[model samples]
Target: MPGESELATLLRDLKPMLAEEEHGFVTIPIGSGWPQGLVPVATFAETEGASVIALSSILDGIGLEYEEGWAKITIGATSALSAVGLTAKIAAALAETGISANIVAAYHHDHVFVPWARRDEAMAVLENLSKVQE
Candidate 1:
């Protein structure tokens, strides 16, 4: 099925859910292969290195230096890649409360990463957005 593209509908249906496992960010320098048995939820290649998001425990076990203590919030709505304003709206709402939001758009949905300690607050913000939009 095609994903939702209308901004209002996207906001109304953003059933944000907090993941149970804590994740972390790690960067592997160019020319270095990924750590053995490391399963990354997401990866991006840049000029300096390959950025990865994976479970905190897995990253620690591999002895990789990473910024840990992040909580992942997955937007339950399947938003289209062409959808606009969703990220901005989410970021703005979270920003109002000083919550840092790092949103990653995948083929079907958007995953938001926020500081572990503020996950509940972030979820509240997102839930409020949905209610207001409804």
Candidate 2:
């Protein structure tokens, strides 16, 4: 099925699921090549380095400097890549509670990463957003 593009529909169906494992964000310098024994869930190349999101355990073992303890919340709704305002709305909602959201748009779904300590609060905000849009 085609992904939903309507903002309302997307928000109404955003069944967020919090991942059990904690993730960390690390930046590998350009030309460093992929780290050994590390499986990254998401990666992005920038002028300075390659940003990678991987399991916290792997990052710690590799001794890489990284921001750890992120909780991944995957929005169950399939949002079209072209969908507008979804990220803004999510960020805004989380910001209201002093939570920072890092969103990643994948081929299948949108994932939001927030501080691990605030996962429950983030989930609650997302659930309420969905219900309000319903």
Candidate 3:
């Protein structure tokens, strides 16, 4: 098992970006069953039968208001082991500083959403990590 710091460091190879952390309409307990026409954006808490999934207000059917302070560090289309590297990097480095991250992987890029208040700090951390990337 890796330490949290180590995990954060490793995640950066995927280069998780800091995106505007907006308030998303969260649904819980996907249940053993799934919702019809459901597309989840961020999932955080999970229980045996329930999980929290956040859907951005951008969804056509969603009329909820969102906070747009989230950050998104983009992974190139060629990135390998994208999730592993991204999870490790943020968990190790930024997570310990009381910063929160919500990771969402899309078809072409991996998006990381951070608190709106700490967006600049998160971006700085990512920029530093990016400088050292291979």
Candidate 4:
């Protein structure tokens, strides 16, 4: 199915759901495999590093030092890459409340990573945004 592109529809219907796990982001050498039993929610290759986002426990278990307390918000819209303003809308809402958002757009959905301590507040902002008719 074609992804949604209309900004209004994207906001109104995009249910932002938070993943239950408390996550963290880390970077290790690209050639090394992830420590056993740890699954990353996302991973990326950078020129200087390989980045992984995974559960805090996994980071601790693996003996890799990492930044702690990140949370993911999965937007329930198959949004087209060309879709405009959705990130801005969500970011703006959070910004107004002094919360920062890190957004990742995948083929199937847009995920927002926020400070773990603020996940519930971020969800409330997104939920309220979804309730807006226009």
Each prediction's TM-score versus the true structure: 0.97, 0.95, 0.50, 0.91
C-alpha lDDT (0 to 100) for residue 118 of candidate 4: 93
Model 2 lDDT, full chain set: 0.92
Candidate 3 structure, TM-score to reference: 0.50
**Clashing residue pair totals per candidate (backbone < 3 A):** 0, 0, 22, 0
RMSD of each: 0.9, 1.1, 6.7, 1.5
Per-candidate local distance difference test: 0.93, 0.92, 0.52, 0.87
lDDT tens digits, residue span 1-134, model 3: 21222334344444544334343534444444655555665555555443334445443355433444344445432333333455556545678677787765554555666776787787677666666654
lDDT (Cα) of model 4:
0.87
lDDT of 4 by residue, 1-134 (tens): 56999999999888888999888888877677666776888888998678888888788887778886889999997788888899999999999999889888888899999999999999998999889855
Candidate number achieving the greatest TM-score relative to the actual structure: 1
Error of 1 at 69 (Å): 1.2
The best candidate by lDDT is 1
Q: For residue 1, give model 2's deviation from the true position in Å.
A: 6.1
TM match of model 1 to true structure = 0.97
Q: Between the candidate structures 1 and 3, which one is better when assessed by TM-score?
A: 1
